[model samples]
Target chain A: MSLVKTIKELKEEIKRMSYGKDISIGFVPTMGYLHEGHISLIKKAKLENDIVVVSVFVNPTQFGPNEDFESYPRDIERDYNLSISGGADIVFNPNVDEMYPDGASTFVNVKGDITNKLCGKSRPTHFEGVTTVVSKLFNIVKPTNAYFGQKDAQQVAVIQKMVRDLFFDINIVSCPIVREEDGLAMSSRNVYLNEEERNQALILSKSLFKARDMFLDGERDANVLRKFIIDNINTKELANIDYVDIVDAKTLENVETINSKAIIALAVKFGKTRLIDNIYLEV
Target chain B: MSLVKTIKELKEEIKRMSYGKDISIGFVPTMGYLHEGHISLIKKAKLENDIVVVSVFVNPTQFGPNEDFESYPRDIERDYNLSISGGADIVFNPNVDEMYPDGASTFVNVKGDITNKLCGKSRPTHFEGVTTVVSKLFNIVKPTNAYFGQKDAQQVAVIQKMVRDLFFDINIVSCPIVREEDGLAMSSRNVYLNEEERNQALILSKSLFKARDMFLDGERDANVLRKFIIDNINTKELANIDYVDIVDAKTLENVETINSKAIIALAVKFGKTRLIDNIYLEV
Candidate 1:
């Protein structure tokens, strides 16, 4: 396994590995804090591709002015071990200056109604930064298949749309989100929560599960599902509701009635820390 | 020479050509209606790379609602002959559907100052379309180096900026403009003018050449050069001036006095046909 830090060195390594051969390159991009969710994505990529590359980048562009960009978290040695064990041939850990060099002015955007719903409402310019960095990664990595976790289902949708609309010749493999035994979604930010806050945060997924059970038991009204989830989260101590939406899974548009596939997504704040969770509902 | 009309066939052919070889592919993308200018670009690419592919696409997104998109010239057969003669090994000619699949919602944009100058001022949404399509083409073709004519100098700058920003590992080669014996810059749109209009259109180039000569003879005042070019174009009957700008060649900013490299560019209309010409100056 080769670890590279610069794009030029990474490109050379990828070239050496892929030269004169038809190697299927798989890529898993993350923000340096490796968890079970990220490992699941890496394992999925490893199983499917001849060569696997994992990138650890804490992209500052995706965070808003008030977002937790400065204190996101980083553990290079832990991540390196986890990634190698999870089956990554190359670990690409580029610095901020390398990923976004001086005078980087171009951006790839998915316009219209797609970016205005769900998580996008709070983080307005978030997806633009996501699409831009992903585009750059796609170009630099030139992967045959790319892995993304379903924990960020909206991000999966945005990236899939970006690839399709931009005509990128790569497959997007969306892996299921890994979670703890208590059913809380596996997230790097979970460490920020105190023990009490951590237990309270489980209510996010617990509430979504309750709503899903209700959904499976003949409840189809979007407003009913949204209100039920919101009410459940409101009862938990130290839990403040951010938003609860029942939206079309594909378009991310709020649906009045759940006649088709939809995502029951929400965000909740546990004091200083904010966490997001969702469940896919299908008729 | 392979002539492909579908993206799939083209991709397969390019892949086959690229497999098991250390080959450098050079690309020339253009709206069909090939002339000596486009041929010059093809010839330049042919000389520099191991394989050459020229794309003939009339991109509609770059055209404004009132612009001449419907009337844009296209001659596939003539273009094929010229491209083969001009040293293009493959001509990837895709339809509108192949280039821009249905529900294409992604776009690449260079914001701030670059897109607001020169032809961009007249066609506001032009460079976005150019970057989007060119980005798509770059991905589809996977060229080592891409060629563009300096006739569209601002486009060259925009594309160069996009390539650098997006981290595309392809070199951009800007070829010099090919001109007629009468000093008129060659353009596919040149066919829109009649004989009288064509004769008067020479003033566009004639004034640019006059300014270049004066600059060589120690004229450095930008205002004076702009006024001189404007006056020379104004004297011709049936020619309506659009704009004359003396701008820094690199930044495309207007200069008070020509202390460094500059581009003295102008646009003029003869009848319903708009013609553009420019001259590069350096101290």
Candidate 2:
């Protein structure tokens, strides 16, 4: 395993590795502060590809004016160890200046109703930022397959749309979400939760799991399922609901009733930290 | 010297040709009315790389509502012969549906003053279309180097900026403009001109050449050079001037004086055919 800091160095290394042979590269892009969610992607990448490259970049463009860009968690030493353990062949950790240099004005955008719902409603420019950085990383890495966690289900859909719309010659592998033993979805932002908030955050998973059971038990109405989840979250005083939506998993469009593939996605604020979670409803 | 119509076939051919042992591809993208201008790009690409791939696509999005997209010239038979004569290895001729399939909504945009000036002023959404299509082509081809003609000076600048901003692992080669024996710059749209319009359109190049000579004789004022070119073109009663300005060669910003590298560019319409020409002033 090697750690490369510069784009030029990384490109040269990739070239050296795949010079006269067929080498399959699996890429996992993340914003530092690694958790089991990130490692799951790397482990899957390692299982499938000859080379696994993981990029840790906390892109500032994805954060809004009032978002936690300045206070976002970052621990590189711990991240490096986790990445090694997860079987990453290369850890490409680039600084902001290296990724987005001066006079960098180009952007890749996936427009239409797809980018205007769910997480995109609150953070209008979030998907644009995600697509732009991902495009750049894809060009730099030239991976055969790129891995993304389904915890960010909307992100996966947007990225899948971009890859198809742009005709990128790479496969996008979406890994299933990883969760803690207590059912709280694994997230880097979990560190922001204090002792009291930590215990209170469990209500998020509890509500989601309860709704999943009801959904399995012939609960088909979107309004009733949405109301149940919202009321359940409101039970915790520290929990402030941002949005609770039951949308088509692929299109991210609202569904009247769940007859096919749907996702119950939500974002809530536990004090200053905002966390997102989702459960897929498959028929 | 194979002509592939689908993106899949072209990509497979490229992969077969470059399976191992270091193969460099040089790409030239064109709308396929193959003139000396496009042939020059292919010739240059042939000299520089192991294989040259010329894409003949008449992109519709670059044309405005009132522009001549439907009447745009195309001749695949003639294009294939010219490409073969110019030493091209492959000719990628994808239909509009192949390049832009159903549900295609992604776009690559280079913002700021670079895309707003020059030809962008008359055709507002032109560069967005150019960048989007070119980015898609780049991803599909994965060429070692891509070539563009300097006749569209602003396009060369915009594409260079996009490449720098997006971190695409390809080199951009800008070739010199190819012209007619009488001095008219070569373009696919030249086919739109009738005999009378053709005779009058020579004024576009004639005025530019005269201005270049005057600038060579120590005329430094940009306004003076601009007026000289505009006056010379206006002498032809059939020519209707669109714009005549002197701008910095790289930045495309309006210049007051020619202290460094500058370009005096103009566009004029004879009948319904809009013709463009430019002359560079290098210190």
Candidate 3:
């Protein structure tokens, strides 16, 4: 139930925990405004480790010039209570100056085709920010296992790649995405939508379900499946489609025929807010 | 005196150490040869931290094709003695497999104009390897303070930038270069030079001194200083000049005049080996 604000305090607190020989530490890192999705990640971490530490940081480096960094929602007190309820042992809530000081300059880039596809195409520096912050958090916590939600699919992939490439001695465990009863993916940005916009936002998850239905019906052509999803989203008046594609689940590359594993991912703009949803289909 | 190979064991050992509250951890990473240059770095780390960890990793990622990766010198026992003698609390000597497992894919790049100049020109992938390995070492050790020799001046600058940009919680302490009695900067590569080659290798450092002499004598034109060094190297029949330049110290861009801080660096081929040396002058 205790909240640690600085790296020094956090490290000191972590050292005091009775992490005996072979003790496993679990970590969940999130940009606050904690909802069911973030809670799910923290809950999973709690299940797997002797101690679980959750960090809430709204990193600025991930947002582009035109992106909504200034207006990103935050509620630390609420987040703190939720984290404790979710079974988190410690909550690391560092300020902007604590995580990133004045004149700070290092960056961790997850390179290659993985970074150039999907969400990377729209927000170029987003993964870099995620990777860098994740790296910093990993070093701070030094957890045995770290939990990530599949809501940010590309983020999961980028972090996996970075951990593998860098030889970090920690396990990266990805959990399933949490969704609302209406099938809309749970996200902090969902709070920005009005009642009518919230109703229309359900189309994103519906389009993904439609694609899933096509896969269930034995349709495998990536192009045809992608077109079907795009066409469905295009029909929605409020949901303006940003991108729709069926790509390899692992590589995130556009596959011609979905013979193995494929993912259908799309980003839709519902008024001023953007929402993303994806479904993984395995043949 | 115990040697730990696996990361699991190393972490356990580190956890047992009583790094007192508010105590800083200082790290010095090197490829083992037990040279005075490495010892100098270790001594500095000891002075700066309550606990000192020195990592000896022969990072394969930093070696180029036709470069001496296999033939890289190693004496772990000697290195162990040297590290202990220099006051290093722990020596993290992980093998290549431990550091980089099969099918590793992540890399850390310290970009900008600093990477495009000096040693970067001839060894294109060298800095990438340096940056990547140093990043891995930094993550594994998780030091409060890390030490590097200014012998690799460009590398020190790149690491400083990487630590700042990436938001790693470590202080990068740059120590002065250790030199031989004859003025040659100590490097593992210095072992590649034959007796005559070693003697001829003095020209690399000698040229820097010549540049410094000119700068102290109120020489302002960078081109004239560069020409003087290149002409001096050309006069030595045993030396083949690889690159000679006078550039801005910080940006590494070629300078028209030496009215500001500048670095005069050069690489020379002596028989089959390449030796590099440089001098920074506040002009």
Best by TM-score: 2
> Which residue pairs of candidate 3 clash?
A104-B164, A105-B164, A105-B165, A106-B162, A106-B164, A106-B165, A106-B166, A107-B165, A107-B166, A165-B106
Score residue B213 of candidate 2 by CA lDDT.
90
Provide the TM-score for each candidate, comma-separated.
0.94, 0.96, 0.76
**Candidate 2 per-residue lDDT over residues A121-229, each given as its tens digit:** 8999999999999999999998999999989999999999999988898899998889999988999999999988888889888888999999999999989999999
Put down candidate 1 lDDT per residue, B54-120, tens digits, no spaces. 9999998999899999999989999998999999989999999987787778899987677887788
* Candidate 2 off by > 4 Å: A18-20, B19-21
Report RMSD (Å) for each prediction in the order shown: 2.1, 1.7, 5.2
Proportion of the native interface contacts kept in model 2: 0.88
lDDT per residue for candidate 2 within B100-178, as digits (tens), equals 8987889999998888876888889999999999999998998899999988988988999899888888999998889
lDDT by residue (B77-99, candidate 3, tens digit) is 88899999999888889988887
- Which is superior by TM-score, 1 or 2? 2
Q: Candidate 1, chain A: TM-score? A: 0.97
Instruction: State the lDDT of candidate 1 residue by residue for A84-150, as single tens digits.
Output: 9999999999998898887777888888667777678888989899999999999999999999988
DockQ of each candidate's interface versus the true one? 0.80, 0.86, 0.39
Q: Which 10-residue window of candidate 1 chain B scores lowest in summed lDDT? A: B13-22
Pick out the ten consecutive residues of candidate 3 chain A with the lowest summed lDDT. A14-23
TM-score of chain A of each: 0.97, 0.98, 0.97
Candidate 3 residue-wise lDDT, A136-242, digit = tens: 88877888999988888888888988987776778999888899999989999998999988988888888788878988999888888788878877777887777
